[model samples]
Target: MDTEKVTDRKVELEKEDGHALHKRLSQVDPEMAAKLHPHDKRKVARSLQVFEETGISHSEFLHRQHSEEGGGPLGGPLKFPNLCILWLHADQTGPGPSVPPVYGLEVSDVSKWEESVLEPALEIVQSFIQGHKPVAAPVKMPCNEMENKRSYHMCDLCDRIIIGDREWAAHIKSKSHLHQLKKRRRLDSDAVTAIENQSISPDCDKELKEKGSPEQNEKELKSSV
Candidate 1:
């Protein structure tokens, strides 16, 4: 991929109106559009450029990549099958400090580096090499509900993109969205009422006057005679 060209395209896309670009993307690549936020201009542009250059949708390309050997539905294949990650971070201080998992080493204390960081990381690596599971079980985190399962929805009334059924339902029932709906209905009703109450135009009135009632026409004819 040409990084510079992609960057230029991204800049051009950012210069255009985000909503218009989003609408354009939706028409061509609805799946990709659904996955991206409209305001995420860089990514949105990259996807568009992929289509423009290759005549293939970005979503299709991603699907193909994910279908490759050792790949999962969500992402491309791992480079190393036996890869074991060991994360390291400084110890955090707060009311609710999130401690890292077993393989995650805290490098807060230099004196305890061997005990706190090096030893644990070595053990994890050793287990991987020996084809044995680490002493500590891996933590299982739940997948993101929106990214994994739900489809994106755009609310015409509210002029916003909502992800997932629960969020969409909540948005429609929101006070602001309801207010906008009521305002639009009221405007439409008022327009109808105005049209109904409108008086005849001057041209119509003039025509009516010229073609008077039958009795008036008869009187005018007699007068002329």
Candidate 2:
């Protein structure tokens, strides 16, 4: 629980509470998509711990937009190149990168949409998984017959949230947000190994370095070899 080893330059947390709270808020924590405005120092420290482990601003990363399509703010796709690539596990699936595909489902008026629709869907899925009973095909979308199937815009990066136009444009310009984009661009940079920041903490940095954008590495390998 000792944070004396962490650097202060990486973050400068606001300390306005008592000594206990000051000690707690000393570290940079996850904003959970920047949703909860916490006052407790310990909570801030724990949040920072989660952020460091994931390299994600936990609280800040939550509920990106009022739009429910992807619950939090969206940061489109990978914008960088890959440097070090260990393609030893080339599967028959075309020797390609193992980036998982995302499906951004935009349901119109999702917030007001009845849980009746979702609950039954999950029940059927669970029933199938548990081998409970022989059920027919499955439930249908109650609003399927509605005329205007609302169309939605999806954010590319993180692929989690669907966002409104105004928020989308602003997100593209945020410092932390844009820097993430730059990192994607260098995923395949042939100039250096990704280990330059190897000493960076093991939490969030690990995943960021390992899977920042392995796709870039695959493209580079295919072209060079």
Candidate 3:
């Protein structure tokens, strides 16, 4: 319905430690890691994600990105031209035609992504999704004036402390946490979905699962996305 619909699926994950990105970038490409731009924070974080997930150089990934863009038969032109440019910019579109990214790996935009920024960001993102301990938390608003201030406990999800009596009551009786508990309780419920057990999700697994008993019954979970 909105831009968030498209974007929210991919979390803007960040790590807790401030320099996690730098460390990850160094692992991906030490030379480029040294020159990352301060402003292009998200790109840096993505570089870290790519490296952590695939253990490849960001440059190699970009090269692969270029190669995969055109949707060429081998290394030639794309199958569909009109959809390539307009992107079929519609609601019901599946994935549209494959096209190359616009970035040229030759110049200024090169060192824009750094690991220093990415690692921490990634830590934050992982912590958010997994609900674990964050290396760093967002800064709180400054207390002022009387300083006696308000009294309320922080929310378990976002950690923002309740400010008023009404908020305090609501926080203590949060239905959202109840929903989370309910979801947790349904982790193995038949109606509840399941994901691959890592080794159980490859093509071999997919094929065997599609054929055999107990495996096919697993139902493959399709796309937890």
Candidate 4:
């Protein structure tokens, strides 16, 4: 299918009437429409255009893609299964962005750059070139009642939802999660220090001085009498 032509047609339909296009998409591909917002004109029109051009719902195409070999619930199979990503950063100890299967390079110290970063990176590349699997195998869950009733866990520190107890345990021990936890502890400590060091406002101090105390007033009255 010529995706570019479909895209152009979708754009034309959206320009004409986005609401009407979304309504048409709902009629032809209710599943896709339910997943997308009514105000998402681009996706709505594209789904409609896809149905008009090929008589097949856009959702069906996605289902087929996901059902292919090496594909699961996530989406289509990886274009490059052996893809290697390397991240070079100055502060390895500090909180860094989260991404899976990444090799981090410490670029802060020039002296150790070769020994720490270059050698390790070279070894990884060489292993990959020699047909050694760079990525780890996926964990296989046992087919049982426990697998069926797997509960989801949400990490408040990292703001991520992890499925299955094993995944949740691994996520908590991950570098990203540890970094975020460290950062959170540091922030809490700073907040406690700030609160402890905080002083009374000038206006509040002045009001307290003006009010004095009941005991002080009674003493003044007794002195006057």
Provide the global lDDT of candidate 2 against the true structure: 0.43
For residue 111, model 3's alpha carbon misses the true position, in angstroms, by: 44
Q: Write down the TM-score of every candidate.
A: 0.55, 0.18, 0.26, 0.42
Over 1-225, each residue of candidate 4 has an lDDT whose tens digit, in order, gives 666543477668778666677678878887776666556678778888888888899989888888998765546777765656666754223222222245666677888988877887887777677878544332222233334113456789897756556567788999999999999999999998877655566766788889889999889899999
Q: lDDT (0-100) at residue 149 of candidate 1? A: 33
Per-residue alpha-carbon lDDT of model 2 for 1-225, expressed as tens digits?
A: 777776652244434343343344334542231322244344455556556667665544443432444232233233442212212112222222223221122245568434533554455446555756424232221222222211234447544332334345566677766777787778756334555445465865777876757888798789999
Clashes of each: 0, 52, 18, 0
Better of 2 and 3 by lDDT: 3
lDDT against the true structure, each candidate:
0.75, 0.43, 0.49, 0.69
Give the CA lDDT, 0 to 100, for residue 38 in model 4.
Answer: 56
Best by lDDT: 1
What RMSD value applies to candidate 3?
Answer: 30.1
**Is 2 or 3 the stronger prediction by TM-score?**
3
Please provide, for model 3 over 148-218, each residue's C-alpha lDDT reduced to its tens digit, 9 standing for 90 to 100: 22343556654444554545666657887667656657865633344545445587688875687865456
Which model is ahead, 1 or 2, in terms of TM-score? 1
* Cα lDDT over the full model 3: 0.49
Error of model 4, residue 130, in angstroms = 3.0
Model 1 lDDT, residue 35, Cα: 77
